[model samples]
Target chain A: MKTPGEQKDRTWILAAPGVGYLTVLYALPLGLLLLASFRLPEAFSISAYVDFFGDPFNWYIIWNTLRSALLTTAFCLLIGYPAAFALAWSKGWLQALFLVSLILPLSVGIVVKAFAWTIVLRSDGVLNQALMALGFTDEPVRLIFTETGLIFGAVNVFVPFMIMPVYSVIRLLDPRLAEAARTLGAGPLYVFWKIILPLTVPGIIAGIAFVFSLALAMYVIPTLLVGERFMTLSQQIARSYLYLRNETLGSTVAVVLLVFSLIVIVASQWLAGKVRANT
Target chain B: MTVLERLARLAVWTIGLAVCVYLMVPLFVTVAVSFSASPVFDLPPPSWSLRWYEALGSKRGFLPSLSLSVQIALISTGISLVLGTLTAIAVVKGRFPGRTAISTFVVSPLMMPGLVIGIALLQFLREIGYRDAYTGLILGHVIVTLPFIMRTVQASLSLFDFTLIDAARTLGLSYPKAVVKVLVPVLSPAYLSSGLFAFLASMDNYPISIFLTDARNKTLPIQVLEYLEVRPDPTIAAISSLLILLTIIVLVISDRLVGLRRMTDF
Candidate 1:
C-alpha cells in the first residue's frame, strides 16, 4: 500500500538478502579459491605449483583431461549440429516434440544416466546384445570400461547442451541468406557450409566452451562408466581428497583445473568477440 | 538422384533418429527394469510388476535420503526465489555503478565446473572450520542455483513495461504498492518457473553436495551413487523412475502455470 518510491525502496531492500547471500557464498568462496591458489604451503614454498607443473604424470593427466574433453565436445558437435538443424527446420509439433525429447534426458540425474550407459555398454548390455543379434559381432565387446564408454556417456549427457545453443542460433538465423546463396548458384552443401555454419559460430563456440568445461570437471559419469583405470583429473582430485586424505594435493590439483578452465573461457570469449566484430 | 546422395540423406536421418533413440533408450530401460518381476539387472525384464515401487516404501535409507533431498531442494529454491527476484530487480532497475560487472559476477557460478566449486568450497570450509555441514551444503546449492533464478527473472523484467510503473507512481501509488499490485502479478510466472528450475538444479546436484555432505546428511543423488557402488539393484531404477516422474509432474505443473514455450530459452 506504499507509494511507488516506497515500493521501489522496499524492493531494493528485499533484494538485499539474495545479494548478500551471493556475495558471502559465491563471491567469497571464489576469492578463497584464488587466495588458496597463491598461498605458500608450509614455510613459504611454491612446492604445489612446482609439483603440479614439473611432474610428467601430472602433465599426462592434464593432457588426457583436455583430450577427453575435446573428444567429447567434438563428438557432441558432430552429432548435435545436424540434430539441431533438423529440429529447427522441422514443423511446429515435430519441433516441440524433438526439443522435448532432446532435453528430457537432461532431467535425469548425471549418476543415473551414467548407470544407464553402464547397462547399455557392459559386456552383456543391450548394445552388445543388439549387435550380436544383428550379427555385427560374434562376441561381447569391451565398451564400458574404456575411454570409448567415457566419451559415449559424456557426449550423450552434453549433446543437449550443444544442441540447445546451436538450435537457438539456427532458429534466429536469417533464412533469406541461405535462399540467396542457393539462388546465386550455390549448392545446398555450399550454402550450408558457407552461410549457416559461419553464422552459428557464436553458438558453436559457446557450446564447445560449455561442453569442454563440463566434461573436464565431470566425475560421476567417468567414475561409473569408465571406472578407475582411466581416471580423469576430477577423479584424481577426488581420490586425492577423499581416498588418499591429501587436502594439499587435492587443492593444488583443483587450482590447476581452475586455471585451465579460465584459460578456455577467456579464449572462447576472445574468439566470440572477434567473430562478432567480423560479422 | 545418385545412390550416394540418396544414401547420404538416409544415413543422416538414420543417425539422427538413432541418437534420439540412444538418449531415450536408457531412460525407458530404467523405467522398464524398475517394474521388472525379476530382481536382476541383466537382460530385459521377463514380466512387469510393481514390486520395486513397493520395495521403495520399505527401504529405510532411501526414504531419509529422499526426504533430505526434498527438504534441501525446497529450502534452496525458497532462498533462491527471494534472492534471485530481488537481485533481478536491483540489476534491472537500480542505477548502481559497476552494475554490469556485478551482474556478471552473480551469474558466473553457472560457468564454473561443479567439482571445482565443490573442492574449492570444501577447502574454504575446512580453512574456516565449517566443513561437512548442512550450512555449507545449503550455501553451495544456493550459489549453484542462483543463476537460473536470476536469468529467468531478468528476462521477465526485460519483457516488462516501465510505463505502467511510472503511471502508477504518477497516480499516487507507492513503489511497493505499485510493484505488489502490478509488477509481482506480471512477473509471477517467471518467478514460479525460475523457482522450479532452481529446485531441480538443487535436487539433481551431486558434485557440489558430495563434498559438503557428511555421513549424517547424504542427499538422494549421493545415496543413489553409494548404493550403486555396492550393488546394482532394481530399486535404484525405481528411485530413478520416481525422480523422472517427479520431473514430469513439475513440467506439467509449470506448463499449466506458464506455457512451457516461454521457458525455452533457458
Candidate 2:
C-alpha cells in the first residue's frame, strides 16, 4: 500500500476544492447575509430588525407564511403517513410502482407543477367542469386565486418529502414487532396505535421539519396561484429586490427567512435527539 | 382476512390509486392540451392535432435555449462530478479536521430554498461585476447542484472498500493512478447517476435562474415562464411535453443500464 504520509497528502489535495467552494459559496454568502442584516441603512445599527419587527404588515406576512406552512404540513402528515406505511408494507411490483410514482412528480419542475395547478383550479378549469357536470354547483367554485388553492398546490408538491422520509424509516422497521404484538392477543388497531405510531414518530417529525421549512420558503406556488394579492414573505422579498429595488430591505427579509429556517432546523434536531435518547 | 379487513385494504388501494392520479393528472393534461388543435386553454381538446409541436419545432429561440440549457447542464455536471467525487473521497477516506463541519457546509445548499440561493448569488454577482451572464449562472448552478452530487458520491463511497485502492497502491500504482484505475472504474455507476441528477437539477431549475438570467441568455424554464406570461399557448405545453418525454427516455435508459431504484437510496 501507499505510505500513510502520501495518502494523507493526497487526501487534503482532493478535499481542497469542495471545502473551498462550500466555504466561499454556501458558508460565506450566509455570513454576508447575517452581517448585512445587522448593518443599518444609513449607519451601523440594528434598524433592519427593528423595522421588520415593528411593521404590522411584515408581521402579518410572517404569520401568513407560518400558518400556511403548518396547514400544509398537517395535511401532508394526515395523508402521507398512511400512504407511506402502505407502500412500505407492499410487496413486489406494487412497491416499485408506488416508489416510481412518488419520485416522478419530484423530477417535474416545481414551476411547471404550479402552472399545472393553475390549469386545474382555474374558474373554467377541470375541477369546475367536473363540479358542474356532477350537479354540485352551477357557478364555478372560486378555487383559484385563493389561500385554499395555494395550500393545495403546496401540499401536492411537498407531500413526497413527507412520504419519503417516513417510508425510509418504516421500510427499515422490523415487521415481526407488529406480528408479535398481534400474536400476543393485541388487536391490529391497538398494536398500530401503541407500537407502530410511537416508533414512527421520529420519521414523522423529520418529515414535518422537511415539509414545513420548504413550505415556509415556497415562492412559485404562492406567486402563481395566489398572485400578488396574497403575498408571502418570500414574495415580499422578491418584490423588494425586483420591484421596489430595496436591496437592503430585501436582504433583511431574506435574512429573517434564513433565521426562521435555522430555528426550525435546530428545534427539530433537538427534538430528534430527545426522541433518540428516550427510545 | 375478515370482511372488514378486506374492505380496509380495498379502501387503502383506492386512496393510493387516487393520489397517483392526482399526481399524474397535470402531466397528462399538459400532453393532451399540447396535441389539441385549438390554441385556447380549454379542457378536453375539441380535435386532436400536432400543430403546436410543429409550431414549437419552428420557434426561433426554443432550439437555442434548449441547447444552452444542455450546455450549461453538461458543464455544471462536469464541475460537480469532479468536485463532488474528490470531496466524497476526502470525506470518506481522509482524516481531515472539522470533517463534519465541512460536510455540513458542502451540503447546506441542498437544504436552503433555491430562491434564497438565487437571490444571494445575484447580489453577490453584482458586487463582483458578473451580473446576468452565463459564467454567473454556471457558478450558481454548480454551487447548488454540487450538494446533490456530493451526497450521492458519498453514499457510494461509504459502501466502497478502501482495501482495493490500497491493494492497487501496493502493486506500485501511484496515488492518482490508483484512484483513476481502481476507485473510479468501480464507482462509475454512481458517478453517471449523480451526473444525470445534477444535470436534471440544473436544467429544471427556474427559481435561482430567474434572478440570474437577463433578456439575451435566458434558460428554457425562464423562457417557458416568459412565454406563459405573454399568453397561454399550446406551444408551452408542447415544449413541456417534450421535456417530459426526454426525462422518461433518460429514466428508461438509466433503468436498462443500472436500475433506477438503487440510485434513489442516496
Candidate 3:
C-alpha cells in the first residue's frame, strides 16, 4: 500500500482534468467577463453602470424581468404545493404517468416549448377554440404577446422545479408526526400548519430560488412567446452582443444578471440553512 | 375521517390532477396538432392525418443541424462521463480540504443563467481565437453536461460499498481490475441515467450554442427556433413531437434502469 501522504496527495489528481477544464474554460471566462464590465483602458469605471441605469428603458427591462419571474414563482408555488402531495401519494400507473409527464416536458427543448406556447396562444389557437366552445368567450381572445400569456408559459415550464423539491421534502417527512398530532386531537389544518409547513420551508425556499432565478434569466420562452412586445434583460444582452456589438453594454448587463442570480442562490441557501437549524 | 380532512384531500387531488393536465397541455397540443389536417395549430384536428410527419421525412433544411446536434450531444456526453466519473471518485474517496466547495463550484454552472454563461464564453472564445464553432460548442456542452453526471455518480458512489473492491482484490484481482469488476457494474445505472440526461441537455441547449454557432454550423434548436419565427407551421410540431418521442424513450429506458423516483432523487 502507498503511504498515507502519497495516497492523499494523489487523490486530487482524479479531479484535476474536470477542475482544470472548468477553471480554464468556464471560471476564467466568467472572471474575464466580469472584468470586462469594469474595463476602461487600465482603469475600472462605473460609467457603464451609470450609462445603463441612467436610461429609463433599462429600469423597465429590470422591472419586466423581475415581475415576470415573481409572478411565475408565485403561480408555481400555489400550483406545485398541492401537486407535490398528489405526486408523492399517487400509486401504480398514475405515478409513472405523472412522472413521465413532468420529465417529457422538461426533456423537450425550451425553444420547442416556447414555440408550442406560441401556437397555443395564437388568436385562432386551441386555447381560444376551447374557450369559445365552452361559451366562456364569444370571440377569440388576444392571449399571445401578453404578460399573462408569458407567465402562463413560464409557470408551466417552471412548476416542476417547485414540485420536485417540495415532493422530496414531503417524502423525507415523518408521517407519524402528523398522525400523532391527530391522535392528540389536533385538527388536520392545525397539524399541517404547525408541523408540515415548517419542515418544508427549506424545500419551498429552494424551489423559489430555482424557479425565480431561472425564470428571471429565461430568454427563449420570453423571446418566442411574447417577442419584441416585451423587453427583458436576456433579450437586451443578446441585442447588445449580437446586434449592437457593444461589449461594454453586454458585459455590464450580464454582470447585473449574474448578481441577481447570485443573490437569489446565496440568500436561498442561507434561508434554508436557518430554517433547517431552527427546525 | 372529518369533513374538513376529506374536503382538503379532495381539494389536493383536484388541484394536483388539474396541474398535471396543465403541464401536459402544450405537449399534448403539440402532438395533437402534428397529426392534424389543419395547416395551423388547431385542436381535435379538422381531420386526422400524418401530413406533418411525412413533411419531416422530406425536410432537408433541418438535416445538417440535426446531425450536428446529435454529434455534439454524443461527444460532449462522452467527455462528461469520463471527467465527471473522475471528479466524483475524487470527491467521494479522496480526503480533501475543499470537497464541498469543489462540488458546489462544479454544479454551479447548472444553476447559473445560461445566457450569462453564453456571453462570457463568447467573449472568452473571441479572446482565445477559438477558430471553429464545433470545438467551441463541445467545450460549452461539456460544461453544461458535467454537473448532471457528477451529481448522480457522487450520489450513487456514496451509497456504494468500497469493501467490494477489497473483496475482489483478495480474490486475486488487481486494484484497477477489482474496481472494474466491482464498481463499474454497480454504478452503471447512475452512469446511464446521468449520461442520458447530459446528452439531452446538450441536444436541447440553446443559449450557449447560440453564441457558438456560425451560419454553417447551427444546432437543431437554433434552426428550429428560426423556423418557428419565419414559418409558423405544423412542420415545427412534427419536429417537436419527434424530440418529445425521444424524451419518452429516454424516460422509459431510465424508468426500467432506475425508477424515475430514484433518478429524480439524484
Which candidate number has the best lDDT?
3
lDDT of 3 at B191: 86
lDDT of 2 at A105: 65
Model 2, stretches more than 4 Å misplaced? A1-13, A40-42, A91-93, B1-11, B95-97, B185-189
Please provide, for model 1 over B200-240, each residue's C-alpha lDDT reduced to its tens digit, 9 standing for 90 to 100: 77888998998899888999999999989987689989988
> Tens-digit lDDT track for model 3 on A176-229?
999999999999889989999988887899789889988988999989888886
Clashing pairs in 2: none
Model 1 lDDT, full chain set:
0.80
Interface RMSD for each of the candidates: 3.2, 2.5, 1.7
- How many collisions per candidate? 9, 0, 0
Tens-place lDDT digits, model 1, residues A1-279 = 446665333345545777787777666776776666657433455677897789888888888889999999999989888787776666666655675677566567888889988888899988899999999999998998899988988898888778777877888898899778767988777776789789999989988888888888888988998778886788888898889988777878887787778787778778988999998
Candidate 3 ranges with C-alpha deviation above 4 Å: A1-10
| Candidate with better TM-score, 2 vs 3 | 3
lDDT tens per residue, model 3, B1-266: 89998998998899889988888888888889889999966667889889888888687668788899999999999999999989988898888678877887787787788889987887788887876999999999999999889988998899888888989999999999998899999988888878877888899899888999999999999999888778777887887888888888778877887788776663
